[model samples]
Target chain A: MTDRAPGPVRRIFTGPQRLAPHLAALSESSEYGRAIHNADPPPCDAPPWPEPHGGTPGTGLPRPDPQRSAGQALAVVRSGALTTVQDLGRYGHAHLGVPRSGALDPPALRLVNRLVGNPEGAAALETTLDGCAVRPRRAVTAAVAGAPCPVLVDGRPAPWGAPVRVPAGALLEVGRVVSGVRSYVAFGGGVAVEPVLGSRSTDLLSGLGPAPLREGTVLPLGPATGRAAPVDGVPTQAPPAELVLRIRLGPRDDWFTSAALRTLATRVYRVSAASNRIGLRTEGPPLERAVSAELPSEGMVTGAVQVPPDGRPLVFLADHPTTGGYPVVAVVAERDLPAAAQAAPGTPVRFVAVRHRSSG
Target chain B: MRALPVGDRALLVELADGEETAAFHAELLRRRAAGVLPPVREIVPAARTVLLDGLDDAASFAAGLDGWRAEAPDARVPDTVELPVRYDGPDLAEVAALWGVPAEEVARIHSAAEFRVAFCGFAPGFGYLTGLPARYAVPRRPTPRTAVPPGSVALAGPYTGVYPRSSPGGWQLIGTTDTVLWDPARVPAALLAPGTRVRFVATAAGR
Candidate 1:
């Protein structure tokens, strides 16, 4: 009699009982979910992420089929504190005074893009402390990563890090971050803004690419080339409770006194409210300088920790100028900058000087 | 010449003066164009220093610098841009007073000297040009203008520049030009990249 029962009725009774095993396998063998969680620390000698690929062809990495166009659009409902379209970044134009502006928390943006089956360098929306909301003209798969935050679709609770399908005209709201300072939102196809200098990133310093999102902004979407990843969940590193930055001292270290160097390494500092895309300013004891002469403007890297006359340290970020006049007493390691990007104003910061790896 | 370590992937090479900086920068550019330079991300020159960034091994590069010599840049003709300017700036009279000459003389003196882009900074496509003698250098405005019109020809310290766009600036404006100094749509966007030569030609349209 039980075997003869209709297949639909029998499956309903057994499906609930069989869910645990499927869930277990998902957590155990999900490749897309585990890749970032188990990834090794980037090599110290590796160039900063989103390396300048200006005028270069596509990354040649496997990408979703470009023929499948997702002719849809996203209407911004809430712009939040600050939201900008970003991709990996613009590179190779520093000689023209162009900054390599891109996502500050690149790993987060990359992960979100991956969840949506977009190229890791696909353009996405980077929101500040306050999250944003958008309504898609067509149903699409989307993912949000970076600062942990509550996500809502049409006012109903939704998963934050996993890809979720939003119905056409449904409101996808990224709530204020529960922690951390920024969040990333990616669609199956990236935002289709016109590229400037080989990137879609909005460089606040040089005023390149698209402008910051406005409430009524309408953004075009590229075609969705692939299906979203099958993972039910993604694990992300927790935002640092006490931001610890690894740094290498030099170039202009001789300008600072030995005590100043000690102060930088040992003293506790907090992120300043004045921080912006150009730099992460710190509020703490000023470093004393041995030489007071003005530094001739010189090329500045993304992670340079420059010291101004105020004696405070200003760590250059993605949107930093290609050249600066202030002496850079040290430079934060590139890998550490992702965490720095997520650090909110007033977060405690510690700069730890790491010795250069001697040639083996 | 001094090559100092900047973190793990960059070096700041300091030269004796602006001429030396230009010469060294030109040499680096020549090597890079010839594909003899090691892979590098950027070669940025400033007043007295050149920054080499994104090197595979900054230490090894710095070590190699001891054997390198910067030849006086080749005397080959450089890319030159001619900007026609109308001497009708609000500060033209003040600049004339500073030069101890008539307002008309200010335009003549400025238009006569040839200039070279020393460096680029402050904003994209904005070049710091050098050619005027140190005695002719002018001080920046005591208080910068909230908005300097685009294409305004200006001078401050040892550099002469044109506003690529309307932005806050302190340079003393001496004239105006219609030439676009920067346009992203154009290949090689900046009209005055470092080492490019420039000349200001007086337009017959205005005083």
Candidate 2:
């Protein structure tokens, strides 16, 4: 999906008003992270909005495929819960301020996508805490990823992270629980919806994309080859029941007292219930900054551990704003993004620092 | 003069040079030419200093910034951009109300002079427009609405900008123009780039 288009990729989006630049300046001054380009003409897996290919900004949750439009789309009906469209994220176009709001878990989402031959960054259903049951109006291929739940397709146990075939009117049910905050169900070919802002990922706060799925909402499906073959590059390493994420120090790291920076490297923290896609708030020893100035705003990036006036180091995540004013003491490596993406609330998180001596 | 940590990947650069901002900018430019600090993501220059981003970590990057402060650069400026605007906005009257002057007079003052686009941020395609006329300096709204429609011309606290899309914003709405400030399809979706000269020409329909 490299060099795809002016799609949704996580990058720094400059808002027209003073708030953006103000945040950018603060991000720089505080050593939070650089202003990544949300407007990455082509997409990468990084957040901000990482939807591959440009998306059409749909006003509401996309309607199900045309077959369901006759009366009501009935491929996958969530009996008691809400189902919303998700993708890896709307990649690129952050310069225009689009967010890479997509699947909370990238490896799982990509695993589901490859199992069904859908675009790796295609939009799927990111079902939260509870499970959803579907009544397929027609036959299609799909797979569930993350929060590994008990999914029954055609009344038989459906294997996870692998594609399964369903017949028309076949009831597909998911009821398994495992690690992670969200789960994704990608279909063969892919979820066919009007691409919005170069993504199908719904931005709850932005109001720029579609709404969540409700009862009777029919999802449109693009034609598929009917193959459930698992594609390569999908990480098969099971998500650790517990996780520890490694990180690097910040650019302007001197804001913190030397002892505080040392504490960060040696600390072992756990994700608080308050953590979400926006940021990871940890319950650990608070590090005191050297100076307490109401700093100006500056650029912010994913995995930036920004400590606000309260002194708690808030690790910015996928949906974090393009910029902020808090001083960041560290950043997670690009290679470890998947680990950060799969971090659920209450998950154990430790920051291991790696020093880069490169002058370039 | 002073150096600080901006983020994990950048350094807040201040230079000992009287032209501190330019000196840091020159050093960055030289390094870019020399391909030494490849991780420097964004380098924004101000009157006295520049902010650098894209450092691998905060500690080592800060060390480099400190060295630059001591070794100042001989001076040069980067290219600046120029932007065009139509002065007619819905809040023009409200803004003039604060000044106790006629709305048309405010327009005259706004278009009569030029302003610099200090930075690009807040939303994609949105520019942080600083350098407002002294009389027009106003604070932000006490309570911000949950949603402000896109293209709504707004001003707050000595700054003026347009909402690119519907979003949670605090700026007071002035007037709106049909300019597509951000279109991902365009080469440079952002209508206003940094360091651009701007002039607002009154338009009948935009009003």
Candidate 3:
């Protein structure tokens, strides 16, 4: 595997109707935002691996040995919080028993890139529950998207959505759980990690590739060096109580009885404490299947609602399993993933069925 | 043939011929290696379908089914893989007790024949190997385990498999081994691919 630096990953938003500019804007780089556009890195060592169930604390955000950097771009993950390298996801190998696990809130990940003027698909630090203390090795523009974290740069409060710059050796801190569960921090120079399988996201379930960020892991950084585009704003946490996630009927929507579908459509489902990125388990009235015949296991996409014998439908989030036997009654649209990702445990979540396609 | 839009570059093809799914997937793999597709990221072959995702559009891609469905009817399938396992797990004792048979006899019946990796699912690394010996086959536990160890040999319904990783399961464990069930780092991650043959061997060591 050749060790080449990668290009800035392109982020594709599903819709043109942008929601209100988010609270925290990503800081790709001040003025000249192009520093985040990375070059297409040549192939590196990507071996087939075991499923990683959970990220090891020691390896959470940093690499033991500093990655070979391509340009002057350098960033350091600081103390506290859970920050992991996330690309889109590990794909194709699902048949080989890999989960397409990555960002639970993709829109946030994409927005993080756009904020810093980086391509959306670029690997960024996904901070879950808690965020990290970030330090830039150089004066580079960066942005924070997704979760409602009270961000401070060098002891001064930093705005969340728009891009901001940190001088070399400056201390950047992000406080936890202002509203949502996950936060994405994108550097003007995208965070650089060796791609395992097809992505940079650490597959904790498949015990393959680099571990999640750990202390003393100074990650490799990439330099895009692109001209700054006019910055659009970032999206922040909406009113948590009134968040309504959009849903798309699945191919197997007929598997459930009409009453069951109606109950799913109208009844309130509460996010159980067991919910996480792997999948969201809900506490709701148990669903009953119309037929007892076991359905064949099939491929699933993000947002699939699969029901088991117990009738509890698992709303598969970003790190969901490859395939499932439960019939998927519905799927949450891309537009609604942010809200779904923000569904705090025990948060009352109500599913409303809608006829929406991916309106890219 | 139906073309479902995901976002832009990706497309899903619903194949009616189960045999060709493998064949078309091989063709796509070759294409992927050759750099013919600038966008495709994933090429997923399911029971009777294939979903083509452009690397650039995986997040939001469209599946061009009309062309792919017509083209996939006679594609060449990939080769099958075979697997070996020991039909023993922790739950083997309970299953034998419920069936009024000794664990040794249970092992004999389990090793009697072969199975197929008909499907892969459940957890990340979990593969469904079908075709279990009728006598050894049993219903899943009424109450599932909160967590089952990885590489656990188990049987439930007409299926026998090794748990890829520790996960909640209802299958009866017969034995355990170090052989990884689902390893992503290894090529062909699932040791037992669909259409692959599987035979259980009784060994002196049972974990």
Candidate 4:
């Protein structure tokens, strides 16, 4: 699992300029009939996509015994960056100090699952900045959504955001994210890792669920049910150029100075490079607090906009700690958090205070 | 008392004190169990606030907070769980010296107190108990240990807490407990959820 691809990866093109002939043979095995070799050759200076052990596409790679396609399981070949299994979240355990970890981009997860005929809450693989590659042990219907990326099965280009049936022993590589920080991948049958606290979500803060997918990790998929939704394509929101988070002022806004409150709404902040599942740290003007006293640790929820002594506001995410000592100036709306999750480092962030809308 | 808006779907109801917060939390928990408050996702109780998340309208819910009475039946009827403690800790002598008492006397005072679970945080099943008198309150260690072993009974600033799992903490350690404070395999998982009454029964140090 530790073996990593050396050097930079090659760019995979669509609508084919050139692909090695072996890709067509691999796609013929599946009834899906999706385009096979959509890759254009690398530019003269660019490095070619690495081929493992000089193995030719589809045939030369060692075929482990084919497990039945009834369940869609995949063997990890290249776990690019940080890839983890995620569902909706683990709820009803905040009092016990468990974090509610889930897909940071819920809409993306839901759409991918919908395309693959799985329930919205079904567990799926979430890949970070650089995408991951896996070889299905069995033929499976899957879709890549969220961040736009090059999708390939057995060196053959597959449609992104549409259902693609990947045959057994084919390498399904999700290329580097083009716009967003994370991507969602869903199979017909959900990733069937053992659920902890009734969820398959990997809680990075609490070290829950199966550890982040490493190169040799084999993921078990649930029994396939139903057929992929018949759709040519699904539209998705593009990663925002400026991440604007709408927030409602506060459970503890009084703790901050009037100038600090105004600064929060008016000032533009940039997303910090140190941002992770726990929080979206900002590298902007530090907010000044009116009170310097330490606040007793209290319960914190997802989307809590907590301000530390340093004054930089940290917008909590799915895997945020259940409790925090710092006062929260505001909380971002649940719907806007998905975009917050996709925000890249250095992306401009502006907090806009809006009147609380009653949806109930 | 005031109901502060936490977010669009949650409210942080500020109460007069920790007792009032616990009472309100108990009342809300009762309402949730009875299906009266259906939209409630999580009910988190801190020292002076009870955060209720996943609601339909937080403003309306907060406005209606007054009508929801804290009844006698829901008045902190805590589940008492006795924990056997070995009164041998790194900070036992220091804590005893701070209180101007012998180490055995410090253990005696800790064991005699009928502590109420104030709130659960820091780690799972780690409850901050409020039973010690104000005079007995001790400050946290100037430096925190890199890793405090699980089930370590510790004291810091008017509260006594047991470290549910091994984690870095600044609290002054005074004893150790064999009680399984947290076990995911068991139902409830946390032995000391909020409002669970706790009593430290001192055991022989080497036992």
Candidate 5:
């Protein structure tokens, strides 16, 4: 309720004479002053809101509008793919079947947050594949990181991976990604969505935090910090043509035969299109299970390489289920999980087994 | 006991039984309070295994687990939580018939046994408890209900549990409880955490 935006005046064109000034004001507010001014003058007379229709409590009639304060940040114009608010994650609740859902590529979130002068754990919009466009209610600085995408402000090209000052009411459009699966957008402050269970990240598996972005969803921005880290250029890795995930054999590795383990390490798998925040499903030869007997469900962690009865491996991600029944043959190192997020469908994948507890 | 590698930052410790699992879980909790396992973030206990996540040096921790001792009986027993239940459920008659006992006898048998929280899964605050004798094991509904209401006391193979939130379940419902199993406002939220002991008391009223 605190973040709700004040209602905008419903402008009705009486004649062509009044429309000229409105159109001119829009053009002038751009990076260059064409004809528009900073303030768009309000109409001389505005109609008061109608009284609420009272029939019955359950009656399908319109109720009086709650007080809506103007939002300080971005207004979603076009939410692309599957955008959701994300922070570090919700932790310490795995025993209760809660997954720690956060940004799949944490590095991208940190990079954009640094560019926008926000804290590392602040919530941001994670856009999948095709990017999103937003219009800020107040002037704010923003940066796009993660997957490479075109950054544009009111149809003018803006620098990617660097902070760009967006004037209030200007459309900041992030075009579809050139490569990779997800892109992150960080505001000057951060996404000020309400946190659920100590995290703002949306859990698709458990349905927590803010829901996935839809058109016209207004997101509040936190107050911007003055201290932004200076940077010449932040280094970014390209989307992997072939995702090579380094993993360590697991506690249930003995359940698989030697041939299966060999196949896991040697064979090339393709990233499945069904992959989402839950897990990175694969399409390849199934890893044959030596033990056909059912094992009781066990706790699953991020990056767990669990093999189902079908034999194809599924690398658990940020939104993976807390407990699973499948046997986990290996677990990808935490460091290599970011690359998994960026991997697109049909991208070749290889599992490289490393020494237990070894760093990549 | 065996400590097996899960990944670079986690290790799965397999124990002999649910009692040992509970003891090991309590030991981890005790050590975590003393700041011994500084890097360990989450310690999740299942039926016969405990997963340690976010460990700084998993290999070293696994090595140290070999010498680790299970805590005393006093330390192993977590706080016991009591739930008041009404001995009325849709499946109560079916369960009584299956056990070859009257409906009143079914309630007596369930409340007579002492229960311990073995592990938590399926939903938040939903703990699978161990205490029911093997003879009382009941088959799940051939077709699971589309929605089992929260607080529905249910029994399945080797475990008795309450549905923390409405979800599809195949477990046989024996009764219903009004006790709040999960509250987000409370510290640790889940009332039925792993290792907590539980006792169900039958109430006179159904509603």
Candidate 6:
């Protein structure tokens, strides 16, 4: 495949220029733009379209190693809790029941990838709670972002958020987070696992891509090309002390009693230990249903806050099933999900209802 | 049909039943293929609803859905997948008894019927097939098995399915097949996608 990056024309459409007209129109029609203007701006860091494996073409970034060898790999010395390979995710396959699996903290993953000079959507290791350790076969640049964790090379302290070069065969250890639930560790060329349906992300629900890391696993790395981003430590979001999720009442909101809706908007809920990649289960008063009859299985989406028989709401996550029988009371806005991912068990969660944004 | 807004980017259109869902899904696919349908990331059909997700403007799109009708699907031949099976599951006798047929007749009865995939869920490539008459519908096992081996042809309610992978299931297994239901290496991955016709051909017992 040609390694050409997307030209300037595509960049203009994706950047501020495209949104300028909308902003201008909004300013002219003040009353109509109330809802639309209040909506959060689309994340600027993400490309408008899915980036193909190897590199993000639209970013005008250089492709990682064209002549990468199998010898350029890492040996897992310590596989911490639930470490898995992740990228942006596999998309457009929910019709066949495939889950869109990817890094929970997408911006953090992108930051780490940038620090190591890899594309934003390149595959990397996502460690749960405790971090992991690996020994590179060849000296390579690596960075850790998301959930603020300590970095060590051969037991010596290393920078956490900036790219650090480790010598060949040196043990690069990612220490447990002082807080937060997950952390991302990215290498210069990114993890070079074989892609399944155009993604290297491990789907825990559908059991796709590579399995969770185990001690003694060997992961191949692509060739390093461009230089790491010239930067010191980057700023990162801290784990939420009190998780506040902005939600839009949903397609099945009518199924719930009015009292339930009030409870959802006003009550305080805690993050349950049962939460995982599938859904963020909550510990709180169950929402009373207006319609108690069973709902025939219907398509479920990421961010859907589905309430089961127990009445507690569960917010669907990246690896959620494509369909479900439970009624969805609301959907959390996508922008707030990275904070939800880092919410540790017992963290207080408050769901605030928001008016759906009108089309811009 | 009623289209309800699902968040900012999706609409769940409730249909009358499975037949209506299939027809509506077909019409949506036709419109999409013709580039007339609104931009959507996924058009997923389930039991009695079709979810149009990742819409550019869900409210307007949902408003437009009121005027839409379920068109009769074109009579083009659908893709057919033939799976060879051995009627030798541990629950074969139990299923035969439930069907009020002889043990051997169960295989013949199952092999004679044609099936069409209605929807896929539970796992990737695991299609919920609709073909058997309502009378042939069987209840799920009283208790689920800890592990139902992959390729086990099973029945539950009015649906027939083949386990794509080893998973804990409550379906009544009447036979076993060697066909690979899900292979990520294969293009499209799923051997039996929604709307694909399927036939189970009875084969000799040994591997």
Pick the TM-score winner: 1
lDDT (10s digit) by residue, model 5, range A24-126: 2221111111111111211111111121245111111122122322657578998765677887787777877677888999999888888887767677899
Q: Give the per-residue lDDT of model 2 (tens digit) for A1-360.
A: 001101121222222111121221221211111122132222222333332332222312233445544433345566323345777566444423444567667777777876886556666777654556777666777788776667798679877667777787888887635655566787775666555555666554243344555555576665564367754323345667665666666644678999888888877777665554556677778888997764444556666788865566767666665545566787776556566655655667777877555432
- Provide the lowest-lDDT 10-residue window in model 6 chain A: A1-10
TM-score of each: 0.87, 0.69, 0.68, 0.85, 0.83, 0.87
lDDT against the true structure, per candidate, is: 0.79, 0.58, 0.60, 0.76, 0.75, 0.79
Model 6 chain B lowest lDDT segment of ten:
B65-74
Lowest-sum lDDT 10-residue window in model 3 chain A: A1-10
Look at candidate 5 and tell me the lDDT of residue A233.
49
TM-score, cand. 5 vs. native: 0.83
**Chain B TM-score against the true chain B, each candidate:** 0.97, 0.71, 0.60, 0.94, 0.94, 0.95
TM-score of chain B of 3: 0.60
Provide the interface RMSD of candidate 6 in angstroms, 1 decimal place: 13.4
Each model's DockQ score: 0.39, 0.20, 0.22, 0.22, 0.21, 0.26
Against the true structure, whose DockQ is highest? 1
**Candidate 3 stretches greater than 4 Å from native:** A1-82, A136-140, A203-218, A223-241, A267-274, A281-289, A292-296, A308-314, A343-350, A355-360, B1-109, B141-150, B165-170, B175-181, B201-207
Q: Assess candidate 2 and give its TM-score to the true structure.
A: 0.69
Ranking by lDDT: 1, 6, 4, 5, 3, 2
Minimal lDDT window, size 10, model 3 chain B: B58-67
Instruction: Give the least accurate 10-residue stretch of model 5 chain A, judged by summed lDDT.
Output: A1-10
- Candidate 3 has an lDDT of 0.60
The residue pairs found clashing in candidate 5 are A6-A69, A28-A36
Cα lDDT tens digits, model 3, A243-297, are 4666765556667788988888888888765565566777889877777776544
Model 3, native contacts kept: 0.23
On the 0 to 100 scale, the lDDT of residue A120 in model 4 is: 76
Interface RMSD of each: 19.4, 8.4, 10.8, 13.7, 13.6, 13.4
